[model samples]
Target: MLNFKQPQLRDVIEAPADIAQVRTNLARLYQQKRQLLTDKAHWAHNDAALFEAGASYTRLFMDKMWEAFNEDKLIGDSALIEHLWLQVVQQEHGTAVNVNYADEAGENHVLFAIDQALHVQAHLTAHELPVLADITDEAPDYLINEKMFPALLQIIKLLYAADLRFRSPKETILQPVNDLHFGVKFPDAKTFTATLKVSNNVAVPVKINVEIGHYDVRSFQVVDETGNDVTTIGKPHVSASGTFSWEAQHLPELTNQTLTLTVEAVAIDTLPCLDNLFVIASGNNILMRTGEQVGSFQLELPNKQELGITVNSQDETLTLHYPDADTQIYELAKTYSFFGEWLEATLKTAIIV
Candidate 1:
């Protein structure tokens, strides 16, 4: 832990510490935010930088926290940091972060205490009130409403309904989800990027196909770091759903070249625009997000073969299952929507260097 002090708005901008220090300060601010609750002051808009500063700090903090959590640095209770945030702000769940809306009476309102923290921070930092406890910068804690709540529900319903309505007779093939899952050995691996070891016990030389299909691609280009298109078929042949396809064969025995696809979302000002992005290679499937790369899955396929898996992002937690796998319930990001500004993916064949 680093020595952290409550910062004035100027201190946050001018005397910036390393990000760890910033995180410490931000945590301290959260601990001290209870004072704001009692003051009941209206917000001031002048100290918007407070939001920006806090947002930057919180972003770094969350990243570090996630990294540590993923690496098992936190002994028993890995979710301590996340729990602490929810506890301090009195939120029931993580998604209960700062959310704003007007009440039925048409009065500006917030749905979470995190919002209250931002409100008080703005008011006190603008010098509207004497410094009340450490001014909390809750802007970073606020949840981004990438799309309206109902709109997201519709996407989920459409996908789920599509699965139910379009099931194939014998295999129960979910139209889109099954279309996303077919031909992959491990349909249940939950991850964004991974290297799958192909069993040397197999007889045939390993081969796999990678296909990404989406709607509303703002921009789509697959290339190398030097801006060269490394696709084998000249350029990836795209179909109706903005599909990009690639095939790799005889891996682990030869180090094949790599290819990448950079994608951007088409601008859609219309409300409730339903956009989609999905990638499948080997047995892995992942829903691509804006500014995210669906690449970097490096697997070695030699005499047998290796498969790299980039699993789908259905929600916060991933549950693995076969094609026949079914669950009574599932958890997914309530706010997640495929509509984003850009996406990218890279593919590499497994070969002994």
Candidate 2:
């Protein structure tokens, strides 16, 4: 019951012309196979030609093993047989079943493709004799089993490791090629609104893969006037737009306290310059400072690390010094002067570019 339209076995034939030298080889193969079938003691099936002299060299194996499928046959289709065959010889994966025949120790009747390949390969290697007679076979996974498989695997692993390539366990599946840009509009004191701009350069769906909180700065330090250090004050929350936030209330005594922030960014073999960051606040008086010196600070748009912030003082302008940098004072001219007499700043922000 096979469909010719869908692909069915019209022929099964494989033979090696050189193997014709052994008169008993093919004859014995057939003779023993027939006797085994007749014996029925170990016979798996009747009328199945385990050794077919008339079939082609490789087809002889299929002729014996084909068509006895239980529900859900492991073999995809008869079409797969093409991989096992050339004009006269079968290829690597489809050459033979790996099952070991009873002639060997701990062997079974099931002729798995790999087992058969190994058997044939070993037989050919040991003696100056050819079982198939017509073809020579040697390649990867040809016959991997008990005896030589471990050694073969060891050799392959050594070669693979030597290739100088590393496989990461935690990295995302694929890198995001599309640009990740966002715009932020702080509408009120309690909320921050942002817009995510993404592109469809990748075929797969895009999700936020890079999160700033996951990256840790080993040397991050925050010291309050009470001498309390809270470096791990909740990593800055990251949105699709790359905006990050650090909750000061979560840092124990950091809310109404004076503090200094120092940070360093390090990669495997390289280190970035350690930049000291500080934030001093009392009541409503806020003083934010950064860098080694003030004057050296460049007014680079979009690249400004410490943007303008609100602070108390008649000057209205927040003074941020770069202590680690050359002596420099960056006067943020756009100071939001408050109406109250004493210094008072509720929420501070930079001018939207």
Could you tell me every candidate's TM-score relative to the true structure?
0.18, 0.17
Q: Which candidate is the best by TM-score?
A: 1
lDDT by residue for model 2 (79-154), tens: 2221222121234322333323332344333222221221223111111111111111232222223243222222
- Model 1 residue 164 lDDT score: 21
Once fitted onto the true fold, the runs of candidate 2 whose alpha carbons sit more than 4 angstroms away are 1-154, 157-219, 236-244, 248-255, 266-353
lDDT for model 1 comes to 0.29
Least lDDT summed over 10 consecutive residues: which range in candidate 2? 169-178
lDDT of 1 at 131: 15
Model 1, C-alpha of 271: deviation from truth (Å): 32
Q: What is the C-alpha lDDT of each candidate?
A: 0.29, 0.26
lDDT (tens digit, per residue) of candidate 1 on 136-161: 23223222232232332232233243
